[model samples]
Target: MATLNKGILGGFSGKVGTVVGANWRGLDIIRSRPKNAKRNPTEKQLEQQMKFKLAVSFLQPLKTIQSMYFGSGSGVKSRVNMAVSYTINEAIQVVVGLPELIYNKVLITRGELTSFQNAVLTTQPGGVLHLEWEDNSTQGNAAPADLVSIVCYCEELKNWEIFEGIVMRSDLMADVTLPAYCLGKTMEVYAFLNNVKQTAASTSFYLGQHLVN
Candidate 1:
């Protein structure tokens, strides 16, 4: 019997009439199937696989947002792929509870929103969210009168509170009182500055989650 070697498109397979295909590590090629016996994966290996699966499932829904905010390359497809890879890797690290995974939120793509300096969020005793930032409008593209938009998400209740079009960079600070139901739960906060025309916005910054105080 004669054996033929095909290109990467042909994956490995058992010999059939002297032709076979095989794929390895994403490369498709022609090869004969190995005769080694298969063994069950170790517990650690299975756990890692589960973590990767969970990470993918959690990040699938955010693909649009990722592409919109994280797209950086000259080509759309490359930008999207980079964003997906970033999100997936972040999710996997977080799922595995890595000690370095201190930030639970996804990394925000830096953009026009970089004008604001030292944005901070704090929870007041009365369950009020106090957002403050140093206005660097003169140094950056944003104007002092640019609109500020804030979003708060309560993870436990799956509730969202949005405060938009009511604050400006000139104000330097804003306060948002949480509803009674949102008290005692952890919430994630995001903030961004938008142009006066409302046609453009800076990158949304994750201000970290806080337990309602």
Candidate 2:
């Protein structure tokens, strides 16, 4: 790699013949194109690719939820990108040489707002999702008025039900009714808390997956 002592296009950006031209630091430069290797990927690379695929496929349906609950990323990265990276690195596992998602290790959101305590979920008839959590509003940056969010995913259908329940942190229990279409589908449920201002949210809690009645 070399610097281009000219404009961005002075050295060109594509390959011509055996050489590649590009601009760097306001300078035009020329370099030879490296030969391509037909070698197979290393074991580590294969594992990384598998984990990335798992994370992406599992998270794609929740892009809107991630954008709202995930971290506020920096520079060119958005919240969804950060969420995917986190899932790839932290929530994926190698079981019997196959990549699998460790659902409990996944975080839908992470922030200073205190997370739910002893959170639990129950599936009721008619897509009614009963969520119960001990109030932790006295801890960290949590507040009694903090809003709660429920993120439900149906793996078989690759569908999502993002519900901003009207319950607050002070509410020890709340029932969220999913759409009629989700009544019989198995859903992975997670809950989190966000400040009333919607400026911050707590780490999400995985309440386990169940067949919605």
Q: List the residue pairs that clash in candidate 1.
A: 8-28, 10-29, 11-21, 11-22, 11-23, 12-21, 12-22, 12-23, 13-21, 113-202
The residue pairs that clash in candidate 2, if any, are 4-27, 4-28, 5-27, 5-28, 6-27, 6-28
What TM-score does model 1 achieve against the real structure? 0.57
Tens digits of per-residue lDDT, candidate 1, 1-213, equal: 323336443344446654555556777566554667989999777766665564455445444444554544556465456654565556345344432222354543324544568998999987899989886878757788888877776656756677775688889998988888887889877776777875456767889889997
lDDT of 1: 0.65
Per-residue lDDT of candidate 2, residues 1-213 (tens digit): 434434664456677789987778877677999999799999999999999888998888778767877876556888999999899888888988899877778887877678888888988888898988887889888899998889888777877788875688898898989898887888888888888778788878889989988
- lDDT value, candidate 2, whole model: 0.83
Query: Which residue window of length 10 is worst by lDDT in model 2?
Result: 1-10
How many Å off is the CA of 207 in candidate 2? Answer: 1.1
* TM-score, model 2 to reference: 0.74
- Model 2 misplacement above 4 A: 1-16, 19-35, 72-78
Candidate 1 backbone overlaps, count? 10
Return the lDDT, model 1, position 112. Answer: 53
